[model samples]
Target chain A: SQQGEEDPQALSIQEGENATMNCSYKTSINNLQWYRQNSGRGLVHLILIRSNEREKHSGRLRVTLDTSKKSSSLLITASRAADTASYFCATLLRDATNKLIFGTGTLLAVQP
Target chain B: SAVISQKPSRDICQRGTSLTIQCQVDSQVTMMFWYRQQPGQSLTLIATANQGSEATYESGFVIDKFPISRPNLTFSTLTVSNMSPEDSSIYLCSVGAGKTEAFFGQGTRLTVV
Candidate 1:
């Protein structure tokens, strides 16, 4: 079953603008990760935030997790045209198998 | 970090024909996973493969339709059997350390006519 939903199915922004995408999941998670996919290619891992941690950052990407709310968000600051792609949030359940459940993605189009 | 190589980056197949996608990892890994992504949609995990064991499939997926082989820790394959137009989608292989980040293959895009 699909674990989560991402808000703003599609987003359009200009270069240097900030883009934010949100994800909400159901079950308890050990960690939540952000990934980027250009066109229809493979996914590139961005950053991961553990349930025990509130937020994480890498380069121009910022991710925040709220366990109580069962939601998380990814913010890209000073976005560039190269950042235009589909962003996804995946959850690693605390269960034994350690399978990663991916959420519905957010498509961000950064216009140059 | 693991480097994964997947074969047949894209293919156009006739209905009723089957296609097998292979995934090879640079290093040995315990668990591997397969996922399917339909057009303009999110990825849905098909199954989890453990070396020397039967693949554990998720709901709405069957071993007969999508058979998996984990012959060893560094290699695995997924075959889409009795292919149909509905089966046309991008298939990806992934591997990860326990509860950590995952590494993905380039993905095989299958289009059935």
Candidate 2:
């Protein structure tokens, strides 16, 4: 079963703009990670934020996690045409099995 | 981080046929997972494949329909049996790395006719 739901199922913007996607979950999680998939192919790992941390950044990507609300958000600053892809947020439950429950996903289209 | 090599990147099969997807990891891992993504949809986990044990399937998925084999820590296979057009989707294999991050293989795009 899917644990999280991402809003703004689809978004369109020109190059150099910023895109923000939100994800809300149902249960407590140990950590949250974001992944990007291009053209329905393989997924590339983006960033991971642990429950102990509220925010993290890597280059143009920023992820914020709020344990109290069981939500997380991904901010992509200075988006490019190459940034057009499907973004997913997956959560790792604080359990023995390291299974990840994925979010619905947000599709971003960056026009050059 | 573990690198995975999945065979048969894409295939077109007829109804009632079966397709087995393979996932091989560079390093031995404790847990591996299989997921299915329908057209323009989110990923749904099919099962958790653990080495030396029978795979544990999720709700709405059965072993008879989607059988999984974890022969070793680094190799696993998922077979879609008695496949129909509804079984057509992107199937991906993943392994959990340190800090609970997942590494995925290039998905297999199955198209059933």
Candidate 3:
């Protein structure tokens, strides 16, 4: 079963625009991580935010986590055509096994 | 970070047949898990492969349909039994240490006809 739900199933934008994706979870989590997957390829780890942390930044990617509301958001700034991919948020629940549960994912298309 | 590899990146099989996907990690890990993702769908965890013990399955999944084997900490296998068209999906293997993020394999794209 999926623990996280991401909004905006698909997004299309011109290059240099920003893209933001949100994820909401049903249970308490130890940590939340974001991933990007190109077509027909394995997922690439983007950033991970622990429950104790409110926000984190990596290169052009920014992630924010709110434990109280059980939600997280990933923001990509100055997006490029190469940044086009499916973004997913995975949650590691505190009560469940150590397995990571992923969301439906948001597909972003950056037109050059 | 651990490097994970899966065999037969993609394959097409007939119905009622079985396909065994292999997952190998570069380093020994304590936890290994299998996940299924249908086209345009979210990932669904199939089971957790524990070395020296039976794999633990998630709800809506059974060992009979998806038999998993963890012969060692560095290697595991998942077999989709009696596959059908509905079984067509990408299967991924992941490994993690404790509460940290997991490393995933490239995934095996299976098409059952």
User: CA lDDT, every prediction?
Assistant: 0.94, 0.93, 0.91
True contacts kept of 3: 0.64
Model 2 chain A: weakest 10-residue lDDT segment is A92-101
Q: In model 2, what are the clashing residue pairs, if there are any?
A: none
Expressed as tens digits, the lDDT of each residue in A1-112 for candidate 1 is 7799999899999999999999999999999998899998999999988999998889888899999999999999999999999999999998998899999999999999
Candidate 3's docking class is: medium
Which tens-of-lDDT digit does each residue in B5-30 have in candidate 2?
99899999999999999999999998
lDDT of 3 by residue, A27-92 (tens): 888899898889856888888899999999999999999999999999999999999999999988
Candidates ranked, most accurate by DockQ first: 1, 2, 3
DockQ class, candidate 1 = medium
How does the DockQ of candidate 2 come out? Answer: 0.75
For candidate 3, write residues B14-67 as lDDT tens digits: 999999999999999878999999998878899999899999999999999999
Residues A1-112 of candidate 2: C-alpha lDDT, one tens digit per residue: 8998998899999999999999999987888999999999989999999999999999999999999999999999999999999999999888877888899999999999
lDDT of 1 by residue, B1-113 (tens): 99999998999999999999999999999999999999999999999999999999999999999999999999999999999999999999999935568999999999999
Top candidate when judged by lDDT against the true structure: 1
Per-model TM against the reference = 0.99, 0.98, 0.97
Q: Show where candidate 1 strays beyond 4 Å.
A: none
Give candidate 2's error at residue A92 in angstroms.
Answer: 0.4
